[model samples]
Target: MVTVKMLKPYYVKTEEKYIRIILAYQYFSIIMNKKVYQFIPVKSTEVRINRKTKKIENIDDVFAFQKGKEVLTISMSQLVSIPGFLEMLHRIAESYYLPEDTEAVSDQQRALDQLISELEYENVRRLIDKAIDNGDKEAFLELTNTLNDK
Candidate 1:
């Protein structure tokens, strides 16, 4: 069974009003070699208060049930081709992506250090073999001394 999860849409603020970009799993589909995305416009709700009753009576989802429809469908290629889309995507990624944990980062650094040490050891072993093959006594002694110091 597939569970459908609703993702919080990205809100882009403009000079006039804020626009909600409602993106759902159902809005995207892969057709042949192209990926398609459907965009729906959403508006903020306005609540009205009844002065006589001293209570809030009604609220409306902005642009939910308006007279006209403002739906946009764009393909992956088209979306990328649009100016400022890539910049918007970069901004979104920067805002949404979480930073790496300090502990996890330190662990990765330690692993990298270990791998580098192993590679250095392997390279030294190869150099030692080459020195022995060439009958270079000075190089062999220097290499052995370096290994002993380590």
Candidate 2:
């Protein structure tokens, strides 16, 4: 079994196209034969997170978590498979989407409005994905229309 041992982001880099999140230390570990092993990187690692989907856009970036010793390089698929990996990335990614650096109350309200809209959009989209996964065609069509109206 594989689980995230550590998921604290050391830094988050945001760009117009994508968001890059850097997490270090014992980010993930696996249990084999009743023995636990931590993710150890041989080199620096990075992943590009999609803003809308809140998922890893590609696995081309090198990544293996490191702590002290126990350096074991893992595959991109392995990293992606961790249960909370995407959710963790999404939590960090949302901050970038929300407006920042606002000074006035009116501006703040506008930012909050934008944040609410974005959150609603994301929630609808996520539901749509779940519906597709569950093969609920009715829900899919309704969600598509809702998104279209938005």
Candidate 3:
């Protein structure tokens, strides 16, 4: 027979919802009657708040009870309907298991550099055009020579 024990639970509140995260432990007996316990992590359940009744209820796999009445129920599909909920979950999982500073700063740097290069190109084109229009032969020739060297 296996006996499961629930450890301490935590709660996180977002803008519109609250989530209860529970850590569970399982105790199992082998054929030799040896008992073993294992720790589980980040088992989360959602909690719903009733706006009209101003009631709070904890939700599991079933509907939440509020003041002796069934207020609301959430299925797995309905829970996933919240915007950015999956993304928030992904970030939470990554914070626990992924490497530190795994965000790609180089991609951002590349984008910035690309934007700067585009602006510099436009500025140089305008400068060269102005030099040609003003009959500044030396400046125009110098600019073209610099571009050719690149």
Q: Would you estimate the TM-scores of all the predictions?
A: 0.37, 0.50, 0.32
For candidate 2, which ten residues in a row score worst on lDDT?
A: 62-71
The sequence of per-residue lDDT tens digits that candidate 1 reaches over residues 1-150 is: 111122233442222122223343333222222323233434332222332232223322322212225333333344444455445444433433333566889999999999998898888888889999999999999988877776
Question: What ordering of candidates by TM-score runs from best to worst?
Answer: 2, 1, 3
Which whole-number lDDT from 0 to 100 does residue 84 have in model 3? 51
Error of 3 at 8 (Å): 29
lDDT of 3 by residue, 48-79 (tens): 43322323343344322122232333343444
Residue pairs that clash (backbone atoms under 3 angstroms), model 2: none
Segments in model 2 whose C-alpha atoms lie over 4 Å from true places:
26-41, 65-69, 98-150
Model 2 backbone overlap count: 0
Residue-wise C-alpha lDDT for candidate 2, range 1-150, written one tens digit per residue: 666555666678988767877655565455544556655445645567765556677675555543356445666666677787667667767887635434677888999999999999999999999999999999999999999999
Model 3 residue runs over 4 Å out of place are 1-103
lDDT of 3 at 75: 41
Write down the lDDT that model 1 would get. Answer: 0.44
